[model samples]
Structures are given as C-alpha cells and as structure tokens.
Target chain A: MTEPKVKDNDVVVPGEELASGMGYLPGQGTYRDGDKIRANRLGLVHIDGRAIKLVPLAGRYLPKSGDVIIGKVRDVTYSGWIIDTNSAYRAMLSLKDATNAYIRKGADLTKFYSFGDYVVVKIFNVTSQNLIDLSMKGPGLRKLEQGRVITVDPSKVPRIIGKEGSMVSMIKTQTNCRITVGQNGVIWISGEPKNEIMAEGVIRKIEREAHVPGLTDKIKKELEKTNKGEQ
Target chain B: MTYSKRLDGRGFEDIREMEAKVGVVKNADGSAMFRMGKTIAYAAVYGPKDLYPKFLQDPERGILRVNYNMMPFSGMGDRVRPGPSRRSREIGMVSKNALLPVINLTDFKNAVVDVFIELPQTDAGTRCAGICAASLALADAGITMRDLVASVSIGKIGDKLVVDLTYDEEAIKDMDVADIPVAVIPSTGEISLLQMDGIISKEEITEAIEMAKRACVKINKVQVDALKKKFEVKKNE
Candidate 1:
C-alpha cells in the first residue's frame, strides 16, 4: 500500500514529500525519486486515483494553441506583426491571417494593426520551440479602444472567469460593463468610468482571493454590496 | 582561554531568530523577505521572459542570473559601495550556482530568470540570508524547482564551534576565527556552496559541515512555511 503524506488541496512546497510509495504515480509539478513522490513547484497537491497533480498558485503565461489572448504589436513586420503575448514567446500575425480580404504585398500593415496597439486574437498554431501564430478572423477579435487594461496573474484567470463564465457574466450584468478577459491575464473593460472601475475592482478582488474557497459566492456578495452603495 | 560562552549567550548549535515573509514585492513575479539575527534580505524574482542581447541566449535552457547587493549604509562594516563590488560579484555567482540545480528552465529556452537580492540591514551571514530569501521568492513565483536551498554561516570562533556567527564574533581580535558560509539542498544534504575565511582543522571543518546540514534543515522549514503562508493568509482572511 502507498503512504500519502499530504491530503488533496493541501499547499506543498518544492522538494516536499507528497507520498512515499510506488502505488501512486507522479503527475505534473511532481516527480518520483526512489519510492517517494516530491513536489517540484509551489502549488496545491491533488490526488486523483493513482496519479497526483498540481495546480500552480502563480506563474508566467505560456502560450498554447486555440487560446484567446491579448497581445500588443511590438514590431510591424514586412508580411505580419510581431505581437508580445505577455509571455516569453512572441507571436506572429501574418497578413493572410490578419483578415479575410486580400491586400497588396507592399501595402502598409500598420493601418490594420499598428505598433503599441493591444488586440484580442486567437492563437492558431504554436511550435514546439514556442513560435506562435495568431489569427484575427474569429469573433470578438478586434483592437481594444480607450478603455483601461489591467493585468493579473495568468494562473488566476480561470478563477476570475468562474465555472462556465458565470462569475464574469454576473459582474457584467451587475456593473453594466463590457469586459473581455484574455487567457494571457490581460483584461479589457469598456463602459462608463464609474462602472468600469467597479468591474475592474471586482476582477482584482477575485484574483487576490483565487485560492480561497467559496470565492464565487463572496464575489457575488461583494458586487451586490457595491451595487447597493451606488443607489 | 577557551571560548565557552557566546557573546549573545546562545548555544553552539542554536541559530539566530529568523523571520520570513513571501509576496512582499507586489509588482514582482515573486518576492520574499528573510531575516536572521539583525540581518534582513529582500529578494525579488523576475522573468523566464525574453533575454535580450541575442548572444547570451541558450538554446538548451534559460539562464539564472543573481545580483546580490547591500545598501550603502546596511553593511556591518563601513558604507558599502553602491554598485557591484568584487565581494558582491563573488556572492552573486555563488548564489546563482546555489539555486541553479533546482530550477528547470528547459521550457523557457532563450529566456532569463533574474533574482535580485537586496539587503536593507545586516549583522552577519548576509549572503546566507540572501540565499534563503531567494529560495522563497523562487517558490512564491511558482518556478519549477526540484528543491529549496537553505543557507547559513557555520563557524569556529576560537576553540568553540558555532552555527551562526555575528559581526562581533567575526571581528573578535586575536581569536582563531573561521567563518564558513554554507548552502545546502535540504532534501539530499548536498552542499551547493562552501566558502571559508581564517582557520579550521580538517576534523572541525567536517563537524561544522554536519552542523550546517542540520541547521539547513531548520532553515528549510521556515522557507517552506513562508511559501505556504502566502496561501494560508487568504484562507484566514
């Protein structure tokens, strides 16, 4: 029989022993040395059947295919734009993938996507070496305008979005604001100044308390309190 | 006369009081503060991001760069020069090697992870404290590390062996003092760093290393707790 040292959902540090036996298998963020499984990162330990996994508490964003991300045009290339995906790797948005319409070879691409402009786009392909290709033809993929952007820890994005987008939807309807959350942790809010501030505040709150239990309820209550305060 | 009593009246194996806190630097990816005796070390971890000056990029894996600095007025001696000095550069090099073994940077090829360790105040064992703080910050930043590195200064002051030595202990006049700063990987009892000054007999040095190993285990406990406390605070609140 395997000996499990930590229970599920327990916070573990690097090199901390999670279990001591071959009955359990090591998963992400964990490795087996001899008969002991040790944590390789600072995160929550999860024991699932025969394998143990980890959920990181904080980390930099690593781009993956089919993820909706917010990027800034760092350099306008000859045939595409170099986008900083707020990650270690930069992404390329070729002219063909930039839009549906055809354009001349020497045409100015800045008119479509200029430098220092933030856009919400979908990553279409990612090479093993982390060369990312982006596409702007999908829905809600467009340049962000005048509203402010806030970046939080990429690891907390899922908590801010909630299950099936319920948390975000509630915030949208309650604050009466339009918000787009990028997988890269960059979020855009567009609405009246006061309401937009409230939306941003609520999102920030979620990011801070992402590790705590019953977060969805606490956030809903917070939004209600703020809404009542305005009236 | 044999050095029977510590100046601060602590036991031979006892270390100074330690305090550790994580996530103190809000803007940094990961940050921490560690205190030992009167010394304080604040470390911030940034990156695994793009490394510029293309010549330095490594295709195999990312590089770890550590910069250990002491504020001009924070030194135990005279005001330290504001920038990198011969002493600080050596400490920085060892600190990088101290932490490099545990981190896996293969996923971040051509990138860099920079650790900046700043000391606001110090009594002794400042580099060791800085290494301890750097370990906590790396964990707080969620970097993939095989283990945490815990460090301390184990010394032989006169005829007595000690776990951690203060400036007064190091400055004792006409005493046969050996200040040995050691960094150990707690899990494996592996020494990542070892440096010494003054004199120590072969048998005594071996014994001091054994003591450092145990002291490291204690320090590692504090580092682990600092990382967990970052999460526990949220639950309590």
Candidate 2:
C-alpha cells in the first residue's frame, strides 16, 4: 500500500506530529525505520491518517481588517491620531473610530487618545499606500493602565510563551504577577511591587537567553530558584 | 629621536583589547554589537521584504541597501550628525557592494535587504569593524549566504604596515600615506571588498593587500568563534 499524502493549508490538531511541509516532503521528513513522521510545517499537527499532517500556527501579525492591537499614540493630528503599531507602517486612528459615541467634527482629539496613551484598537482598513485605519471598539480592547512594559524579540515570543501558554502560565503561577504578553513582544506586568519585580526579572532573563537551547529547563530552574527564595 | 613603541606596551601591528558581542538589539531581525578596544559598532539587519516601488524592484534578485551612521558621541572632539554623512554614505554603498557578492540575493526575489550600521565609537578602523559586525549580525539573523565576511584595516605608518589603527595613530601618522581596508570571505579566500586611501607605490599596495588578506583570514576565525560561542552559551542556558 502507498502512504497518504498531506495537503497544504491543512488544519491539524496538536500532538499529531507533522508529516511533511508544503509542496514536496523533504528527504528528512520521512522516518527510516517506522511510519513516524517529523513535522515539516510549524503549526498544529494532526495524526488522523496513518501519517501525521501539519497545520501551521497563527501567522505573524499583519494588520488585517478588523484585527485589534494595542497602539501607542504618537502624534496628534488636526483630523486624526497617529499611532505607532510597532510595525513598519504607522496607523491613523481617526476620531470617528476613536469611540462608539458620536464625535463632533474638529473636536479636541486629545480627549480620546492623548499622546503616549496606549489604546487597544482595531484595524478598520489597510491601504496599498501603507496607510492603516484604526478603531477603538472591541472586547478586551481598551486603554491600558499603569504597568511596566518590556520588549522581546518578536520571533521568540512563541518560545517565551511556550506551548498553549504553559511557559507564561508557569511564570504567573510562580510570581503571582498579572502578566500580559503582547504578540509584538511588548509585555505588561502588574501586581504587588515585589511580584512585579520578580516577574520582570524572569521575563528579562528569558528575553536575554531566549535564543538558547534547553530554554524550558532554564525557565523552570529560574522559577524554582525564585520560589525557594520567596518561601 | 624616538625609537621606542607607544604605551599599551605593544608593537605597531598589535591589535588592542578585543571584545565582540552578538544580538544586542531585541527589535532588529538580525543584530550584533561588537567593540574592539574603545571602538564600538552596532549593526542591525531588517530586510528581505517587499520592494517599495515597482521601478526600484529587481525582478532577478534582492537589492541590498546599507546605511552607516556615526552617532554624535562617537568621537571625543567632533560630534557628527546622527544620520548618514558623506563618508558614511560612501562607506554604506561600499559595504552593500561588498556584501552583495557574498549574499544569495536571488533567494529573496523582489525584496530589499536593508542593513543599518551605528558606530557608537570612532577609531581608525571603524568602517572595517562595522562591516565585520554587520556580517555577524546577518548570520545571527539566519540569513543564509556565502561564508562569513571578515575585514581589517592596515595602515602604513613609520614605513611599516599595522593591522589595526586607533584614532590617535591614524591622525598623527602623516609620513606613511597608504591605508588599505580589505574584506575577505575567509572560507573561500574571496576578495569581496577592497579600498585604498592615500598614495602608495604599486608594490606597497600589493604588499598591503596581501598582508590584509592574511589578517582577514585570522579575523575570520574570530568571527566564527564569536558566533559559535554565542550559540554554545545559548545551548547551555
């Protein structure tokens, strides 16, 4: 009998293992001795077939239509508010979308989103000219209060967060700190001053050594050390 | 009248205390910061992205763009603009030309490879160090290319060529006019970047290039060592 082939863009559940990447399966994807398959794609793996099919994880953050992101209000324009989305392009959040309530024409825009205020917003539209239109209406999308923000390498966010939020969940459990890990490497940690410090330290340590192998062990060791000292 | 070598208790060709680091900036796609003695350089690579305009896009391969900037505090005496200057512009263009020969641009069609170099300190061999740092950063960013590029500046001073020159040495030495900065792909013995400043006899230029090539080969080992050490530390962590 012939082995089943996995198609591209196929969604698979986790723990299924990946059989091959898109197009053609590379020589390394196939196991020499058994039917086991190595993951070719970087996403959820489905093991429904005799072999495993790979489903890709969430793609990198592109300013998609109606997607919500927290933006830092940069410059206030006469007609709109310019936000730095931490992307290559700057987004404009007009006063019309700044709030659900009606905004008067030429009204004071600062009342909605003053400069440097972080606001959760949705991308209403993205133009070919790299112009991004934003709105401030969405669930769990609102202004962020006083919190310490730290940046990480965006590519390493997955590794930092770990599988199914296991890494961050462990950190929160250990430090007793409320942590928000933004997709764009921006993290906000808030809680008691002591827990906040511990969480920030752990995050920075991970940020510094995230590229290293055996990171899970390192994070586990760090949290254990912190726990011992706290106890 | 003066027959003795300078303080630091070293010969003219001796390199100063060298320390190199990779991946300093978190935001850059590829980043490295290296310092040799007091001279420091930070390089960032963000590219293989879509080209801006249709006319500027290359159908066959990616276009490499390099920007070199000397921060105002790079020097003790003169503060330069934060942006690119004439010298930096020329250096950037030359660097781009140098790297293009090593990078497989065709892999990234219709995209642009942009490299930005920031020199936080100024010395005689800033450009050469900048090139080396940028190469390492590119490698750290996982940009598959040809072998790593290594560069060094050798100057003729007091009728002898030195491997690396400090700011004071370059400024004070007016008698020897020839200065050659060469970049080599150490693995393949390929000459990707070569530039000479000041007047020198053809024989001296050839000698300098040959000497620089040998120095570049040694420098390549250090580059490999730095990258390997970085990964080794990561694996242990």
Best by DockQ: 1
- Every candidate's DockQ is 0.83, 0.07
Tens digits of per-residue lDDT for model 2 on B1-237? 332464456676566666667668766777777676788888998855666876997767667888988899889778776765688889998888777776766555566767899988877678888888888777666554545677888777666667776776676643654567888866456777878877677787777777878887667666666665654565554
Q: Pick out the ten consecutive residues of candidate 1 chain B with the lowest summed lDDT.
A: B101-110
Clashes (backbone N, CA, C under 3 Å), per candidate, total 0, 1
- What are the per-residue Cα lDDT tens digits for candidate 1 across B1-237? 678899999999999999999999998999999999999999999987898898999978888999999999997668888998999999999999989888888868888989999999989899999999999999888899989999999989878899999999998886788899999999889999999998889999999999999999999998888888888988887
RMSD of each: 1.5, 10.2
Between which residue pairs do clashes occur in model 2?
Answer: A43-A57
Top-lDDT structure, candidate number: 1
For residue B22, give model 1's deviation from the true position in Å.
0.7
Q: How accurate is candidate 2 locally (lDDT)?
A: 0.67
Model 2, A113-231: lDDT tens per residue? 78898776778797644568987766666777886777665545667688898889988888887777766556778788888988888887876675565677778887898689877
